[model samples]
Target: MNRNVILTCAVTGAGDTTGKNPNVPVTPRQIADSCIEAARAGASVAHIHVRDPETGGISHSTDHFREVMERVREADTDIVMNITAGGGGDWTPDSEDPTRGGPGTDIQTPAERHEPVGELLPELCTLDCGSLNFSDMVYINTAEWLREHARLVQQAGVKPELECFDLGHVWFARQLQQEGLIDGDPLYQLCLGIPWGAEADTETMLAMRNKLPDNADWAAFGIGRHQMPMVAQAMLLGGHARVGLEDNLMLKKGVMATNGQLVEKAGGIIENLGGRVMTPAETRERLKLRDPSTGKIVGGEA
Candidate 1:
């Protein structure tokens, strides 16, 4: 069991979850507030995504991103920001013309995905290693696209959190490491319980965990009901944990949960299992994230 665990709270996801869960932050102000609340409750990192304020739909607008970043920075909190570079990959085939994209399809080139990260220069950003079926829609991140995205992330001097939804994704992430695309010790987030991807179970998590690089700093999160259980499982297996409204919406079966409540609960679980949640500074040190102002990796064992 790992004594020190870094808990990242994914504040609001790029999902159609706001209507499902009233607490899912829609506007930039709400997202920034939720991020701060999670940080105060023991989250070491805040994984962020923006949405259209009027529609609450996922948006790739840099203006929205800037607003959230400004609010978070103005607050002067200790949370390490990790923005999503995983946007603009949704592709649903049009029934009328199968070759063309469908109504829900929103695909962007690799450079588009890297725009927010490159412009804002967050401490960390995600690099989705492969494409997979996201429910009925296909989230496309081909090898070529990934290579371009990885290179841009490396250029921006931001660490990429290799997000693996399945075993194949994990394999490709290792390949990226072999090719010397990622810098510093590799960081990963094993995304389980998403439909048509990896299942949320001990056997699955363990199998995927075994495939990661020896020096990787990895965390795992299960969507919906599997969220809290996977948190415990991840900690027991010597991996880190993630929580918040992005992966789950409730403290229990019928209860509506906020991001702060979820972080507090996850922290309680960590302490119960004889582990402690690492602070934001500690996680920054472990990931070797560049300081937001200095453009230099913070102090650590390295």
Candidate 2:
């Protein structure tokens, strides 16, 4: 069992979850406040994804990202900022003309997807390692696209959290490592319980965990009801944990939860399992994360 775990709270995802849960932050102020609250509640890292305030839909606006980052930094908190570079991958074919992109299709080039991370220079950013059938929509991130994205991320001096949705994603992530695309020891987030990707079970988690590089700093999260259970399971299997409104909305069966509440609950679970949640400083040291200001990999507490 891992005695120390890094707990990351994905404050506001690029999902249509705002209407589902009242606490899902939409505005930049709200998202930044949630991140601060999660940090205070024992989340070492805050994974952020901005949304259009007016529509409550996922947005790729750099201004929205900037405002959120500004607010979080102004709060004087120490949570490691992990911005999402996984946007603009949704593809839903048009009903009228199946040949072209439909109403739900939003695809961007590698440079476009890397724009926010490149400009903002956060400590860490996510790189969805492969594509998958997300529900009825197809999330596209082809091999050539991933290679280009990986190069862009490497140039920016930000650590890319290789988000593996399935076993093949893990395999491709390893290939990226082999090709010298990823830098440092490599950080992996084994995203589980997302429909048609990887299941939220011990066998599946273990299988993915076994496939990771030995030097990798990895974490896992399960969506919906599988969230908390995966927190415990990840800790037991010697990996870090992740939780927030992004992956789950309920504190329990019928109770809607805020991001801070979810982080507190995950921290409690980790502590209860004879493990302690690592602070942002500890996580930075462990992951060899780049400093937000200097863009240099740091060793000790900042």
Candidate 3:
């Protein structure tokens, strides 16, 4: 089991979850407040995704990202910021014409998807290692696109949390490392329990964890009901943990959970498992992340 754990609270994801949970942060101010709340509640990092304030839809606006960053920075407590760079790959085929994109389609080039991370330069950003059958839609991230995206993230001096939704993604992430696209020891986020992706169970998590580079720092999370359980499972398997409304909505059956509540629960689980939750500073050193304030890598890993 891992003694020191890093807990990441993904404040709000790009999914259509705002309508389902009232506590899901939609506006920039609300998102920033959630991050601060998670930080105070013992989250080492806040994985952020900005939404359209007016419509409560996913947005790629740099202005919105900037606002969220500013508000979080103005808060008293500190937490490592991990912005999402895996947006705009949704491809729901049109019902009328199978060849055309449907209404839910949101596709962008590597540069467009990396715009926020490139501009804001957060301590960490996500890189979805491969595409998957994301619910009814196919989230498209080709190998070519991934290599280019990794290069851009490396150029910005930001650490890309390789988000592997399946075993093949783990393979491709290793390939990226071998090709010298990823700098330093790679950080990984094993995503489980999404529709048609890796299953949320001990066996699957272990299999993926076994494939990771020995020197890599990794965390794992399960969607919906598996969120809390995966926290314990990840720690037991010698990895870190992640929690937030982005992956799960309820703290318990029929109870909507805020980001702070999720972080608190995850922290409790980590402590109960005889593992200590790492602080933001310690997480930076552990993950070799760039300091958000100075933009220099910690431990001289640059």
For model 3, state the Cα shift of residue 102 in Å. 0.6
Best by lDDT: 3
- Candidate 2: 10-residue stretch with minimal lDDT: 293-302
Report clash pairs, candidate 2.
none
State the C-alpha lDDT per candidate.
0.92, 0.93, 0.94
* lDDT computed for candidate 2: 0.93
**Residue 296, candidate 3: alpha-carbon lDDT:** 78
On the 0 to 100 scale, the lDDT of residue 80 in model 1 is 90
Model 3 Cα shift for residue 247 (angstroms)? 0.6
Local accuracy of candidate 2 as per-residue lDDT tens digits, 110-153: 99999999999999999999999998899999999999999999
lDDT tens digits, residues 1-302, model 1?
78799999999998889988899999999999999999899899999999999999989988888888888878867889999999999999999999999899999999999999999999989999999998999999999889989999998888999999999999999999898899878998999999999999999999999998999988999998999999999999989999999899999989999999999999999999999999988887887887776667897421
Alpha carbon deviation, residue 183, candidate 2 (Å): 1.0
CA displacement after TM-score superposition, residue 204 of candidate 1 (Å): 0.7
lDDT of 1: 0.92
Better of 2 and 3 by TM-score: 3
lDDT of 3: 0.94
Worst 10 residues of 3 by lDDT: 293-302
